[model samples]
Target: MSPDGMFLVTFSIKNTSKVVGREVAQVYISDLQSLLPRPVKELKGFVKVVLQGGETKSVKIDLNHEALSFYNDGQMSWVAEKGKFEILLAASSEDIRLKNKTESSSTITWTRL
Candidate 1:
């Protein structure tokens, strides 16, 4: 996902007939640890959602300016930042299966128009 602009992706998950457990959806913005010369901004927080078994639910991931901001030259690196970001929608953090994954990368940019 682009660093400067808002990115939104929605995907669905299928819940089988297994005994109902607390179904939660989480989104993570990663790749800040290995940025060249380090990244000025760091992504935080995970959006959690709940669902039920035998049900299909949609998870939306939104990337905002505040969540993708960094510092450069004593100023916030408002642009010219790029990296691979992973948008994960999972029932739980440890469970890799029964989840969806999306990835993208782009230079950071912002505008008021």
Candidate 2:
């Protein structure tokens, strides 16, 4: 980890189906709170990539302190709090494959060194 505790977000896309075609994968990284009843932040940009069928593509998202930090004890820490994080990796921004849902929703807890 860096002094700021920033890290890279890496993901892979695999063609599970046997069908062959040009697949374009659009990956997104956003805060979980935005999907809540009362959203605190706005949607960010897209991390786009194109891949072929049966091919696996890797994507990296640079996460800084501001992007991963949360208010803790009157200060922000380099910790992605224990809550569901929204990661959208799909064919399109609005179009998502139910069976191929790439977004992972889970709590991210980090240990401070």
Error of 2 at 66 (Å): 2.6
Runs off by more than 4 Å, candidate 2: 17-45, 69-113
In model 2, where is the ten-residue run with the lowest total lDDT?
Answer: 98-107
Q: Pairing residues by index, what is the TM-score of model 2?
A: 0.40
lDDT for every model?
A: 0.49, 0.47
RMSD of each: 5.4, 8.1
Model 2 over residues 38-68: C-alpha lDDT tens digits? 2333233346555556677666666543443
Which 10 successive residues of model 1 have the least lDDT summed?
A: 95-104
Q: Best candidate per lDDT, number? A: 1
lDDT of 2: 0.47
